[model samples]
Target: MALSIVYGILTTVLTATSWRLGLAVDGILWLVFLVPIILAVIGIINAVNGKMKPLPVIGGIKILK
Candidate 1:
C-alpha cells in the first residue's frame, strides 16, 4: 500500500520530467509488484496449514518483539 503510493508519486514526477524515465520506472514496478502477491500467497498457505512461519524478506521485521 505504502509502496504503491510512493511508486505513484515517483511515476508522476518521473513522467512529468521525461516519458522515457517514467516508462522505465513503470516497467520495473510491474515486475516488483509480483513480490507482494507471492508473499501474500505464502502467508495464506502458512495460515491454512496452521503453521507459524515467517515470510521471506520483510518477514523478519518485528515491531512487537
Candidate 2:
C-alpha cells in the first residue's frame, strides 16, 4: 500500500520530468510495482480462501506496513 503510493508519486514526478525516466518507470514497474502488487493480491486471495501463506518475497517488504 505504502510502496504503491510512493511508486505512484515517483512515477508521476519522473514521468513529468523526462521521457526517459517515464520509460524506465514503465519498464522497471513490471518487476518492481507489478510483482509486489500481484504477490499482495495473491496473499489476500489466499487469506480469503482460508489458506494461510505469505506472499513469496513481497510479504517481507515492510515498506507497505
CA RMSD, predictions in order: 3.3, 6.3
Q: Which residue pairs of candidate 1 clash?
A: none
TM-score of model 2 relative to the true fold? 0.47
Winning model by lDDT:
1
Error of 2 at 42 (Å): 12
- The best candidate by TM-score is 1
Query: For candidate 2, lDDT tens digit of each residue in 1-65?
Result: 88778878888888889979887986787586567688778888998999977568755667754
lDDT of each: 0.90, 0.79
| lDDT of predicted model 2 | 0.79
TM-score of each: 0.56, 0.47
